[model samples]
Structures are given as C-alpha cells and as structure tokens.
Target chain A: MNDLTIIITLIAIGYIAGTWAEKRHYRSIEKREREFLDLPAITIKNVDIDDAKVKNAEIVYGGAVISVDYFKRILAGLRNIFGGSVKSYESLIDRARREALLRMKTMAPDATMIINVRIETSTIGRKSHKKSVACLEAFAYGTAIYLKG
Target chain B: MKYTARMPETNVNVTPTSPLREFFVLLSGVIAIIVGIYLLLGLALNIIVPRIPMTFERKLAGPFINSMASVDRSSEKAQTAQKLLDVIQKRYAKLPYTFTVYLQESPRINAVALPGGNIVVFSGLLEKIESENELAFILAHEMGHYVNRDHLKGVGRALVFIMISAMLLGPDSSAGNLLAQSLNVTEMAFSRNQETLADEFALNALHGTYGHVGGSADFFIKLSKEANTGLWGHYFSTHPENLKRIAHLKNYSRIHGFAEKLLRNIPAIINKKRPA
Candidate 1:
C-alpha cells in the first residue's frame, strides 16, 4: 500500500511536470528553429560550392540529454506488456533530437550552412554496474562551412 | 535546388492523438486484463481446490512447512492442543487429513490453519485460553476450515500468482509488483461468509465432542474486552464483527438446542507462560 502511494505520487508529478516542460521546450525549439532556418542542416555529404569561397569548414556538434518522466516510463512499461508502438517515448526522442539539432545550429551562427549532419541517440542511464540517472543523450554533429566574401 | 526552408505542413512524426488519452486507454486495458484474470482465478479455485489430494498438498507444503519445524511440537502446550484437536477430529470433525499443532513463541494471539493439516498455535493465544472447551472450539474452527477447504482457497490465488509471475515474467517484474500491490492481500483472506460457516462448524463440533456448546463464543468474548485496550491483533481488530460472530454463535446454539454446559478446564500447561 505504501509503495503504491509513492508510485502514484511520482507518476502524478511526472505527468504534470513532464508535460509542462515538454511544451515549453518545444516552444523554445520552434522559435530558435525559425531563427536558424536559413542555416540548413542537411544529411547529404556532398554540396556544390567552390573551394576558394569556403574559407573555413569545421565540425560543429551539439548534444542533449533528456530524462524520462515517471509517468512516461510507466506508460512505456505498460506498452512493453501489450507489444505496440511506445508512443510515450516518441516525443522524448523527438524532443532530444530536435533540441540537439537546434543547439548544433546555435554553435555555427556565422556558417553558410551545415552539411553531412548525423544525429546519434544512445541511452546513458539505468545500467546494472553504474549508479546512473535515467536519461537519453542525442548527439548531433555536422560540418559548418564558413564562406569568405 | 533552392531550399525554401519551410517547416513541414504538419509534424507527422508524432501521432496527433493525445498521449494522456492513450495512457488511460492502455492503463485501462492492463487493469481490465488483470481484473479478468483475478475473476477467472477465483472461478478456477472453485474447480481446483477439492480436486487436490491430501498427499499432493503435503508434498507441496513440504518446503515452507519444514522451515517452521524449529517450533516445538513436543512441548506440553503443543501436545495438549494437539490432543484436543485430535479429539475434535476423531469425534465430531472427521476430516481426512491428520492435524499437527505447532506451538511457536510469538506475541501474536492467533492460530493459522496451514495446508496439509498443520495448525500453528502461537503461544500468545494458548496462554490466554481459560478453558479446554475454548481450546477445543478454536481447534475445531481450524478443522472447519479444512472441511470446507477454505485454507486452500485462501492461499491458492496468491500461490498461482507468484508461480505465474515466476514462470512468465521474471520474479521481479514491475507488473507483478504492481498487481500484488493492487490486490493488497490481507493476512486473513477468508471472506466473512467463510468465517461464519467455520464458526458454525466449530459450534457443531463443540456440541458433539463436549456434549455442549458452552464455550463456543468464549474466545470472542475475551477478545472483545481486550479490543478496546488497543493490543488485540488482526483476528479481533473489528470489535463489532467479533460481537456479531458471538451473537451468531449464541443464536445458532439456541436454534440447534445445544445447551451450554459446565466448561472443561484446559491443561495447566496451556495457561502457564513459557520461559523466555
């Protein structure tokens, strides 16, 4: 009975707090995304540009770690039993990936564009041998090309 | 190609359906399945309990019951309790299985009717018995549970759950933990009706063995007085319920014309406290 009460309290906190944080994050992510819209982050390795015009090209990277709320974790655990799409985790991954990309764009504000962008997602939490907090890290890396006038 | 830099018309990656809505739906689905299994298990118990043979049950009870072997079975209090239980069993409650009484030195005033005819009599309850008739009634009550196989039904559901969890999900699955928590199984799982029937069985057995129903409700009467002191354990927690059972015992005695006779004195060993 005590355990159930604690679990329920955590889930309630997770739902209320997690949803609010997600909404605020998505709002900020969209505003910054629009601001950095012209500086496109593309996956293609090749780009048509003169070598002389490209004054500097270097790798820019951004990483974001998002911890799962108790509510979403419970929802995903339920989903695991039912064998279906884990919708609870979908927004988590989406937020982390987008946040990483936005941060990568913020790193190269003066660049012409970012190309050959790759986003790598990995879980760095809840391992048996380590005392780690539960969270997922999304790391985005790309080449930021600076064009000389 | 000119990159228009247009955000997609819609965020198709995430399904537009409300996550809370999905959460509720899936949560309900899980709850519904659990409730369904619980009901099915209840029905299955009705079909399964009586079919279980005494020998098989003794074998199944071997591991856990043996762990309790350290509790003295040859002591005077235990032997006396066993003798009374045997008399009740042989004369009135002719149940198939042989009952062994174990006396454990515990402050909890209770007797648990374990599977395979093992009645664990806590010294707390033994030290309080004022008469042999009361002890006989208590033993008969446990035997009554055996007669109706209520003991098996009481444990069958929980045993099946643990086994199912161990066999399907590993023992530590959160779902199992959640289900176990949700059920919140009490120490006493026998329903009120089952308890009333057991009381009736004990009343009849007392009348048959002792030629009277003199002390059928004596334990409850003693328990009711102590209930207000806040020291009584789970068995008598509900004072009103104990009163009701006392009334039921009297009414049943009157209806059956089983007269209250002179009470028999319990062996001196039962009333004496064991050395710590």
Candidate 2:
C-alpha cells in the first residue's frame, strides 16, 4: 500500500484499540464493584478469636508482600508519573495497608501504643513468567499497651 | 495511447468522506463517553453513599481520640454534670439499659455514647445549648446508645470487617491481612436497619424519659440545618442522614401533641434572646 493508505489504516487500528481498551477498563470496574459489594457476611462464631496478647496489653503487628507482575508495575509507574493521582495502586495499596493495621490492633486490642510501624514492597519472589496473577507483600509492627487512655 | 498530450486531462473519482459520517461518528463518540461516565458515577455513588457510615467512623475515630486526649477533665463542671446524669439515670432506670454521662471539658458542643456503655457530653454542648429540656434531650439520645449497646456493636462491626477481609483474601499474606484489619468500615456505614433502629430507640427513650413530644424532633431539625452547613460532622457521621432523620422526627411530632409543642417551644426559646 502507498504511504497515505498505510497512514489511514494505522489511524483506524488506533481508534479501534483505544475504544476497546476504554470499554474493557469500564467493564473491569463494574466487575470489581460487583464482587466487592457481593461479599458474604463473615460471621465470628466464636468471640474469643481476638488474640490473647492484645487483651494483655502487649504490642504486636503483622506484614505481607505480593508481587505486582511486570505489566501491572509498568502501568503503575506510568500512572505515577502523571503526578496528580494514582488510583490503580489505590485499591491494592489501600487494602494492604488497612488490613495490616487491623490485624495488629486486633492482636493487641488493650494496648494503647502501636508505634514504630513499617511497610515495604518488592518483586523479588514474584513468578515473572505468570501472566494471570500479580503479588505484593506488606509488613506492620507496633507496641500494644492495654491502658484505657 | 499515442495521444498522451490530448488525453492528459482525466477525472479521478474520489468518494470524499461525508460531513454526515463525521457528524454521526462524533455523535456516537460523545454518546459513548457520556454513557460510560454516567454508568461509572452511578455505580460509585451507589456504593459510596450506602457505605458512608463505615467511612465516617474511620475518619472520626482518630479525631475523637485526639480531641479526647487534649481536653482537660479536671473542671468542676464534671460534678454538676454527673449530678444531672444521676437524676436522668434514676428516672430512666425502669428502662432496659443503664445510662452513664461523662462531662468532657472540650469547648465543642456535642454529647454521644460509644458502643458498649461509654457516654460523653462535651462541656461545649452544655454551654452552647439554651435550656434544660435541650440538655435533657441530648442526654436521652445518648442514653439510647447504652440501651442499645452501640459501643459494643461498633467494635463488633469492626471485627466483622477484619473477618470478611480474611475470608476474601487468603490468610497466607500477612500484609494484606494486617491492612484489612485496620479499616473500621462498620462505624461509617451502619446497616440501614441499624440506623432506623437507633432512631427508633432514641425516639422511644425521648418520650419515656422526658414525657415531652417535640424536644427530640426539634433538636433534629436544628441539627439537620447544622449538618447542611457542614458544621456538625460528629452528628452527621454517626446519625442517619440529617434530612431523613428530621422527616422521621416530624412524623413522631405529628402523633404526639406534647412533642409538637416542645418542638415549637425550641425556636421560641432560642429566638427570644435574639432580635429575629
């Protein structure tokens, strides 16, 4: 094909791909919202599930890390460069951070002080070859004081 | 083909792109974008509004704790407040739950109870309020918290969140597990059923304790305005929607003439001191 014809074809392909990607992103959000809202009620059959150490006023915390896979990280890095906001990492990082604090607090409920917290992320053990799943690990720690301040 | 000079001028048919096609394409693109945005916003608004209570609690906890820590509790108002609480408590002892009142020295006007039996009335609330009836109404509403054991429920709801997260995200990842545990969504988004329950409980206690009809409803009306102005996040966060609560309170006022008078009396009492 001539240059003019080739340019027209490329433009068409770009439009189609952009439309498809936009639609796919919307579909994914809808799916995520559905799953999040549909979560079943997690009942505690036994109330004593609270860690004994927390009740005793001892400090404690928990951590975990999951790999983000190559593609996701590249996209995340691109998003971060935009500077205004990074919403993709929001759900992933938000979930990770909140869950860590919760477990530690539950573990040391009576403790008043929960300080010296730390969080880290890495791709060291990530199965790079896998395309379906991404992973990251987070760690949290603090002193738990059982005082009613 | 030999007559090249004479046949040089030849028309080449080019089916030029039509403006109509351009218009329609642009129209479709705009429509697609509008529809996409509408759907996304609708979904988010639905989820966000319903779960606001969970967000409210999470946001309020730190501020409340900080405020509590900063206030001085050594004021003499504590004794007087405790006395008033004793009288109110004794009168309502026939009810299902015990009521306790704490006189906090903070300057902000507020009184509330935590899940379990923790009740607090800010000195600011007392100082800013106009009359004994208003104060009594506030106390009664807080007492509703104890009767319902809302503090314990608050804690229970937080725990439920942790459990839910654990179930959804396998227990293997410690970081995910810990982060999930930190969120206190239950406090922000009380089940719609729970919001209704608390309102009913407070309304019932209002009548039982004060023998007045409109006092509680009147307070709600005032509170609704404050909420709209974004001045009362404490009440806004914990209580049901201000307008909804006011409407329910109005309904209660309709059934009880005494409450209607009390409601009417409130504006008069507050207004008597001012020109308007």
Score chain A of each prediction against the true chain A by TM-score and list the results. Answer: 0.95, 0.43
DockQ of 2: 0.01
DockQ of every candidate structure: 0.30, 0.01
Residue A87, candidate 2: alpha-carbon lDDT: 37
Consecutive 10-residue window with the lowest summed lDDT within model 2 chain A: A38-47
Query: In model 1, which residue pairs have backbone atoms overlapping below 3 Å?
Result: none
**Model 2 C-alpha lDDT per residue in residues B1-276, reported as the tens digit of each score:** 121112113212212233235434444564455345534543454444434353354454545544656343344454455554566677653444333345665555566665323467676566556555555566666665555445545555445444544563445455334544333333356444455565566566556567764456555666665654455765566667778877776676566543534432222222122223
TM-score attained by model 2: 0.40
CAPRI category for model 2 = incorrect
Cα deviation at A2, candidate 1, in Å, is 8.4
Predicted complex 1: DockQ? 0.30
lDDT for each residue of candidate 1 in A1-149, tens digit (9 for 90 to 100) = 45557778988999999999999998998888889988989999989898988999999999999999988888887888899888878888999999999999889999988999999999986789743347999999999999998
User: What is the Å distance of residue B161 in model 1 from its true position?
Assistant: 3.8
Best by DockQ: 1
Is model 1 an incorrect, acceptable, medium or high docking prediction?
acceptable
